[model samples]
Target: ITACYCFGALLLVVASICDLVSSIQLGQDSGAVLSRPANSSRIFYGVMFDAGSTGTRIHVYTFIQKDPEELPVLDNEMFHSIKPGLSAYADMPEMGGYTVRQLLKVAKKTVPRLEWKRTPLVLKATAGLRLLPSEKSQALLEQVQDVFDESPFFVPDDSVSIMNGTNEGILAWVTVNFLTGHLYAETRETVGILDLGGGSTQITFLPKSKKTIGSSPDDYIARIDMFNSTYELYTHRTCIKYLLCHVIHRPPYIIVLLYTPGLEWRVFKSSCLPKKFREEWSFGGLTYIVSGKPDGESYVGYKLCYQEVLKVVKDIVHQPYELKDTSVFYAFSYYFDRAVDAGLIDRTQGGMLEVRDFKKRAKEVCNKMSKYRPINPFLCMDMTYITCLLKDGFGFKENTVLQLTKKVNNVETSWALGATFNHFQNLKIHR
Candidate 1:
């Protein structure tokens, strides 16, 4: 009868988790089967849907509570994803809901029919829907609610909603910490997270110094109560895709583009891109025409690209007190992608690197565009942009080493797992 639900920025199926926690804590010696387990093992499933900007994903998590009074362990996860996220159907609310319906097929097949009525279903959306018009966003959410109501799985209150930016950072921090064993160990030591997603990027960690908390912008800090302790984490979100979108009214993608003085061209050029590269890119439902100047005999490589990227990051990103010294950071998403594409790390095993490692590779890639061109067209731009982002954007020193990973212990290093953990704590499960 354990149940939970999720659909949003990350996939989370926490229904069974909440119930399992509740049951374990409420367990007492009694003749009733509800008060004590009739058997030694109890198993349940949770269905989570991640309605992201680029895609919609599902995570069907099964957990086992070995003892009646102990915490449950995640047994397995069945993950799947579909393209063209709900945001793509901004004008077609019903179709967005239909996508949810289609993903539910996996849930139906995964969870046993005997437990279907008791299994909980939930969905949470992230930056994608958050960027949409209010009317359009609500229409899509309402349609999904209708689909949930029609499904056989247990539907909980607030089953569909948009996740705020702050929670996104906090949960991701929790996920990495949990996977790294920092959450359960005796030590408070935890690694910071640098996640660069398509729409936005986040920086989060448990601040060691009180000054770190005091100096940060009020909104950048979040208070989290977990494992019987409270932590004030330094968390913030910045629009890494600032130059990609042109909409002036959007909240997160806000940017002030600087142009060359008295340049007669209408296009905005970046040294990060290939000098000869000219193409149209689309983001947030808007298309932008961009290209690099090929004719000019200029060194528009890493050094110049670094300066240009600095314009977007400098004087903006808040430097954490701990970042100045030494700290471990697990950079993922675009960070991992670019590193693999740049030959800095193995795509499957992943590898560690210093912030300057990225810089060195960026310089090499940007200078020898022709050699790496066939591997990936954006190799130069991506490598250079990431280098600038880590060094200039976050103000990390060249020698600052980051443990870049896409997964830890087989589970993905994503915000979803941390968010799932929070779901139970938020409910205040007690015996």
Candidate 2:
């Protein structure tokens, strides 16, 4: 049985690789023009599904390879998204499969009818599914597989699976770099990536200092070969949702244990929340009654909020060496959304801001919680938490400039494209 699973996995990888290479080869005869010969007008498509914590997005990419010697350039991408995520269907696996089936209709309409069998379809679930119980996750995946099996498009055995947190960061890094043209640049100039998702956060970058790699935990440092360049990448999962917000309910004694066990969970408190506010929050199938201290003392400003969020991050997050150095970082997901909500950046066209900018904004937001309450109840807590995550968690200096963006060159800034690139590179089809 184990051997069967391994063999199935191997076949799945080979299928994905072949699907990507065939697409590239299909467009090799043409370099330009719409009035080209039938052979020269060959166009191929690839579909990638990003099942995130917040929503499920489909990226229908069209690629044309003018020269076989050069990498295929992305011609266009048709993107669409639906909310509530596949993880939200943990109990109703059939409904989750139905969601995927609904998204497949978009791909069917986007790709040529004759190309349905040739076009490859894949879905990569993120931390949302990872946070679910193993059984529930498996059931959801199985349902997705069933839906794929029923679809007209080519579905590889590994078409649907939960992506690793580390690879999540790496793929996002590749997508941003590729879009920014850094991946194919002559020099090794690359920007770092900080992705803050609801269920997890990822920090990935190329380390310039030897101390950064040497001091990091063995697993935190990963080496990946891509774009014909081998890169030693540093990834820190500490900022992940696993530890970031687990502070609210932890018992004082097990505070050392951190993320207090599920069985021991009780009413959680933190200054990050409004002093008089208390609510029930749900995540990963678990609900917690969380609130600020019930004591008579009123929580006034970011001072207390900062300290509360700090305990969840300080000392636990690794400080990347040479962080004071000016290196461009593209932060997105929750980071982008929060910045937009906080009025730090434009929603349509993102802007640049510094690490200290986030800190300062967080202080202002938290201090004026009452004023912003109508906009978002958790504005203060979320801002303060992100502030601490960047400054204390990442050890970034106040002046560290980060480009907070949602897209680059009109392509949504996420890991879907990078994962697609990985599929394309893994293929080794000889003429």
What's the count of clashing pairs in each model shown? Answer: 15, 0
Model 1: lDDT of residue 386: 77
Question: Worst 10-residue stretch by lDDT in candidate 2?
Answer: 249-258
Candidate 1: tens digits of C-alpha lDDT, residues 1-431: 22232221111222333432331122222211223234536566677788888789887766555554565555556778898899889999999999989999999988888777656687889878988899999999999999999999877776799988778878888878866777665677888999887656789988888888888889988888765557788999876444443343222222233244465433456665567777654555665545565766375676776677677767767777767775889999888988888899999889989998988888898887777878975676677667777776777888888998877766667777676666644542222
The RMSD of every model to the true structure, in order and in angstroms, is 6.7, 6.8
TM-score of each: 0.85, 0.83
In order, the Cα lDDT scores of the candidates are 0.71, 0.71
Global Cα lDDT for candidate 1: 0.71
